[model samples]
Target: MSSNDSDSWGAVASSYVQVERLTTPPCQTLVNRVSLLLPLNVPNTIAFDNGCGTGVLSAVLRQQYPRLPLLATDASHGMVNILRRRIEHRKWDEVRTRVVDSRNLEGIQDGSFTHVFSTFMVCLAPEPDKIVGEMQRVMKPGGVLGLAVWGDPQFGPFSTPWEKACRRLVPDYEAPMVMDAKWTFAASVEAGLVEAGFKDVVVWEEDVPWRWDDVEAVSKYYLEGNNPGNVGMIDAFKARGGDVEEVRPIFEGIIKEDCGQKDGSIELHAPATLATARK
Candidate 1:
C-alpha cells in the first residue's frame, strides 16, 4: 500500500459514531482500569480524555469522578457532536467536548490538568511520541496520566481476525502508526514518558473476554463494525486479484470457525494494557 492509503482512518471515526461500545453501560474492563488507578472516590481535579470516541470512557470517568472537570476530545466532528448530544441530554456538568488532535494539544494549556486519559487511541496516532509529549505538557507536575492500548493480538479476539483478513488482502501492507503491546515491553511507553519529562511510571494489564451468543453473529458484527475501514483494504484486495465481495463471506465463515464454541457462544479475548505515569 502506498503511504497515502494510511491516511484513511477518518472513516473509522465517522463509522463508529453510534457504535455499541459507547451506547452500552460501562463494562467491567472500563470499571476495573479506573478503579485500579483512581482513589477510593472521585477527585476534584481537571481531567482530559484524548480520542474520546462517542464519549464512552469519558462518560464513565465523569461518573466515577463527578467533582473533576473533564475535557473530552477527538479528531472527528461527528464523534464530537455525538458526545455533545449524549452529554446534553443527560446534563453532565463541567465536561467540554472538542475536535482536538491528540498529536498536539495546542489549544490546551501547559500544566493545566490534574489527570489525562486515553484509550485505544495512542496506537493509532501518526506521531505517538508527540502525543505523549502533549499529554505530559498539558498535565501538572504531580498529575496522573492514565492510558490503555492494544495488547497482544493473539489475545485481542476482535482484532486478530480482522488483522488476519487485512494481511491476507494486502500482504505487503504494514501499519507504521499502530502501536502494540510490545511497545511497553520495549520501553516505548517508558522512553516516551521519560523524554516527555514524566516520572514514576507504572504499567498493568488485564484481559476482557468478549462473548457473543453465536459465532455467526460475532463474525457478522465484526465485519459490519469494521466495514468502513475496508475501503482501502477492499481496494488492496481487488488490486491483488481478490474479489472482495465474494471473499467476504468466506472470510466471515473462517472467522466464525476460528472463534466458535460448542456451547453456542463465541468468545474472544480483548486484552488491554493500562498505564499510569506522573508528570
Candidate 2:
C-alpha cells in the first residue's frame, strides 16, 4: 500500500477479494453514504465503480438500484475475472466489466459517467492526484465523485504478529502494507479533491465493521490457502523464498490468541473516511 504503483495495488486488491466477508459491510456502507450526494434512480444516472475489486460496489448498486447501469473496473485481470464470474452467477445484465487501471482510464471517454465511486482504493494509488484528475475528466460537469479510504487505518490485533512472522520467514524484510499514511486524514482527502478541480467537497468519517466468524478460514487465507487471489501474503512469502504453508499454523495460533473474543468471534476496529465532491 506504500508504493504508488499498480503492482502493489494489484497485490493488495488480490488479497482483498479473498476476505470479502469482512469487507462487504464497508463497501455497502460507502455506497449508501455516496448515494446521498448523487441521485441513482434517475434514468440518466449511470454509475462507474472505479477500482472495483471483485465488483462489490457493483453488486451493491445493482441490488439497490436495479435499473441503474454500472461500469465496474479493476487493474487486475484475476479480479475482473472474479467479477465476471459473479456477474454471470447473479445474471446482472445491467453491469459491464472492464480491466482498466484507474490512473489511466483511457478506454473511457470524457464525461462518461454521472456518478463515480471508488471504495478502499484512493489512498493506495501510486498517482492518486492523477487518478483524481482522470476522475474529473471522465465525470459530467455536475457529476459527483465519491470515494472512500481508511482515514487513519487501525491495524488488527494480529498485525504485529503478522509483521514479525513476515520477518521470521523473510529475513530483513520490511512488511508492505496497503494503508498509506499520506491519505489517512480527512483533511488531506478534501484538499486533494479540491485541488483536482472538484467543488463542494465533503469528507466524513465512518467506522467500518471488521469481524471474523471463523478463525480457521481467516488463518488459512492469511497464509498459503486455496485462494488463487492470495498474492498479498503468499506472494510476499514466496518472493522472499519462504514457505507459507509452514507458517500457517503459527498465524492461526496468533489470531486465536490475540484476536479471539468473548462471544466466540473475532473483531477489529476499522475507522474510514468517505469523500464526495462535484466535478
Candidate 3:
C-alpha cells in the first residue's frame, strides 16, 4: 500500500472502530459462514485474520474456537493498536495482533495457518493478486481461505447520494477506485483465488441492510466515518476548489431526496460478496 493510503487509514482508525460497532453484523455473518465451511475441528487448528480492522472477526473466531490460535494482521499501525487493545481488554491470549501489509505479509512463514480470512479489506489492496498469493502462501495445504468485499455501488443506497453529489459538485470528478484491477467483480475474485492455487472457489453475493434512525446519524457514521470512498470524494472535490462544508446542505438534501425518508428513518442496502476456497 502507498503511504497516502496508510495515512488515510491511520487518520480514520478511531472513527472506523466506532463505525464497525454498527457495521459488524454483515461481517460477522460472513465470518460465521466461512468458519462453517472450514474443517476447523481438526487437531492443532491455527487461523489467520488478514486485514483484521478492530478485530471484530477475530473476536468471533475466538469465541467459536477458543482453543484455536489466531494471528490478526493489518497494514495500518493505528488499526493494529486498536485491535491489540481490544484483544487485551478481552484477555484473549489465543489471539495475537501484528502490523503487516496484506500483499507482502513480510514476517509470516509459508504454510503456517490452517485457515486464513479477510473481511472488507480486499477492496483496499494495492495489488489484490499479490494479496491472494500471500494468503495462499501462508496457509497449509488443506487450509481454507475466505474473504468479503463490496459489491456494486449501484445497489448500495447509502452510497449513491455521495456519488451523485460528487459528480454534481465537482466538475470532471472521477470517483477514486477502491477495488482496482478487476477485483470488484465476482468472476474476477474467483479467478484470482484460483490463480493463487486455491480449490473449490465459491463467490456469492449478500445484501446487508443498514438502518439509521435519522439523516444526522447517517451523515455521522456512513458518510463521514465508514465509507472511505465518500471521504476521498469530498477531499478530491475540495482539492478542485470546491467548498465541501459549504455544500453540505445541498448534499444532504440530495440524499434525502434520492433515498426518501420513511417513518423517520433511512434504510440502505449494502451489497457485498463472500468468497471461500481451500488452499
Maximum-lDDT candidate: 3
Ranking by lDDT: 3, 2, 1
| lDDT (Cα, 0-100) at 178 in candidate 2 | 50
List TM-scores for all candidates, in order.
Answer: 0.77, 0.79, 0.89
Compose the digit string of candidate 2's lDDT tens values, residues 1-279. 122344544444455654566557777776776677777898888899988877777888899998899999877776677789889998898999887778889779999999998887666566777777888999999998878887653243335556666676676654456555656688888888888899999888876656777677576555544332234545666677867676676767666777778876766555777778888
lDDT of 3 at 43: 84
Q: Lowest summed lDDT over 10 consecutive residues: which window, candidate 2?
A: 1-10
lDDT: worst 10-residue window of model 3: 152-161
Query: For candidate 2, what is the lDDT?
Result: 0.73
Estimate candidate 3's alpha-carbon lDDT, on a 0 to 1 scale: 0.75
Q: 41, model 2: CA deviation in Å?
A: 0.1
lDDT agreement with native, every candidate: 0.63, 0.73, 0.75
Encode model 3's per-residue lDDT on 1-279: one tens digit a residue.
776676668778887754475447766776677778876656888989998887778877877777788999988888888888888888898888888878899989999998898887776568888888899999999888878877763334544676576667675765555455356668887887888899999898777776667777777664567356666656766777777666666667776776546676766667777788997
